[model samples]
Target: MLAPESTRALFTGHSLGGTLSPMLALTLAGLGALKGEGLVYITVGASPGNKGFANIFAQTFPTSTSTCPETGYAVWSKNIINSRDIIPQAWCMKRILSPAQNVKNIPSIYGVPTIPFIEFVVFWLNANANKSHIMYAPLPITSCWASSLRRPLKTWLSFWVSHWGITMHFITMCWV
Candidate 1:
């Protein structure tokens, strides 16, 4: 049992775990197991949820600079996203298709003709799984975009690296 006044919870996760962390935090907060002011969640590469859930979560744990009596800091959550990473943009129809569309617009540098196929797959997935009305709206927390270099090759490499490895390392280093 936790005394809300004294107990501070910091929930942190990457990728799919990122998607779950805030949900868990919200559950705990709703159950009166933790106080909103004392709860903080930091997530990277988090998958998107429906706008309604995002709104409720944001209302439950709003981002504030005001100090908490217990922790002396009152940032309820931080969503760190890599700009080039597609994971964070998923599950939302418009967002899921935007990257694919962007790729389709780009001329194939290597003449490989792979972008069309990739676009087809993305469209298929979005059509099958994404709900039109359930758009993604991120929590009203302090969010940061860790953007990679703009060049094509570098962007591609950095996207994979940031999503798979560097983002976690950077977060870990911040704590250490």
Candidate 2:
């Protein structure tokens, strides 16, 4: 829908979209209808896995035969990530880029206030001996979940108490 003359620019999805926007720009150039100039991509809470895909995708674009116009194209890719957000903070795009590429990391605070809950989920499962090694048991698939729901209250209490002190600080970050 982006005609060369009529099209101003484009945008993509939240996390996955950030990684794919650059590739879309390259495709536009290959079609001969769009130049690389004035392309902009902004990703929030983006995933690091995209870095590997983007590096390989850019190489496939027509680099030799059709160089980006000398009009000084502006390909602005901005990634705004919350410090507590585990997904985007995990990977480094700079490590993947070759010497020729320039990518800057800008730190920002945005989105909801929430602790890293995954850690607690893991803790609860591990502390309960009955719950631990859940995969080892071969109970009827339907019965497994039903049995878990009926686990003794003491087991649940012990699991929470064991990790409560340790995870308190982790949970506070969600509020602070």
Candidate 3:
């Protein structure tokens, strides 16, 4: 994990590492690294073997804690996952354990509630604002479902066939 004042990009490994990257991004943003024009991207791999990571992330710096370094600045953050990646499976399990649990802090404005994650993620993806904030890359590189989207596609059929000892890329597509 990068220090609160570091200028480096904060990335994490699969599973818990992936979860940590975004939390750190939020922390840095709260401290002001992404003020109106900063960028942060977290690419999570596959690691669902650990638990309690998300809780630690959510409660890391509670609202009651001291203000972050850039409390006044806005930051841009994104989460990317491969469509066939099993690491996200762990995230799904985590969610099941805690449903409807607010993932991010919601600020009160004129008595209205604000969801920062939605605002940054869902909205940004819908707009494709210059580039997608989160990219879901489908697997097999060539299947009905894989070719169905407008995302970039590459030919990994041979690799997939050799990797899983299967003739079709369909199976691996699920983990892409």
Candidate 4:
């Protein structure tokens, strides 16, 4: 191990990194690497680990009981899922209900018990996550998104340089 007084640890990741951030945080915390302080896990377009995995994480790291994530809010780890991203919707869950619904939805099966829920799922599927996932604008409904796309190549490069630096704040800006 490096010297305890050397440098504090911070973990940042995207996509899978976002998924692993919390797991690593939990592991490091258990190992006392955090030294009783909070470790920040920041992510962009984070796929939802909010199901069973999150439940287990909560049991171990229960300092904050807040499950609700606000847009553009930076706290623990910011799991920013584009409103249109289906990957984030396709959750990793241990609940039997998900699998049961899957089996029931098949043509061979009759009907799923949660017909309404399935309808909701179908509606979401119809929405097409891929189409909206690419378009982005900073939250608070500013012209950044549209204007960014319309900018000259020179201007666009400047924005990427300024906003695309390696930082969680920039990551959040990209998502929101």
Query: Among these predicted structures, which one has the highest TM-score?
Result: 1
Over 4 Å off in model 2, which ranges?
A: 45-75, 93-176
Pairwise TM-score winner, candidates 1 and 2 = 1
Q: Give residue 63's error in model 4 in angstroms.
A: 7.6
Ranking by lDDT: 1, 4, 2, 3
Give me the candidate number with maximum lDDT: 1
Q: Candidate 1 residues 1-176, lDDT tens each?
A: 76657566777666777778888888888888884344545555354565677777777766655455344223456565544445555444553433432222323322333355445645655554443344555554333434433465555455547575754563355343
lDDT of 3 by residue, 1-176 (tens): 43344444533433456555555655665675644433333444332223344333334322221234243122123234433332332222223343321111112111133335324533332343224232222110111111222221222233334555532353344334
Error of 3 at 130 (Å): 39
Over 4 Å off, model 4: 2-8, 44-52, 59-71, 93-176
Pitting candidate 2 against candidate 4, the one with the higher lDDT is: 4
What's the C-alpha lDDT at position 40 in model 2? Answer: 36
TM-score of each model, paired residue for residue: 0.60, 0.33, 0.28, 0.40
Model 2 Cα lDDT, one tens digit per residue, 1-176: 44656555654445667545655655666566564343434344243334444444434332221153332222234343333333343233242332222111112112223224433443343344223232121000000011122333444356458868755664454344
Residue 156 CA error for candidate 3 (Å)? Answer: 19
- State the lDDT of candidate 4 residue by residue for 17-110, as single tens digits: 7666766876776676665445444444343333455555555544322355342334444454433232333432222424422212322122
Worst-scoring 10-residue span by lDDT in model 3: 137-146
What lDDT would each prediction earn against the true structure?
0.54, 0.37, 0.33, 0.41
Predicted structure 2: clash tally: 0
The TM-score of candidate 4 is 0.40
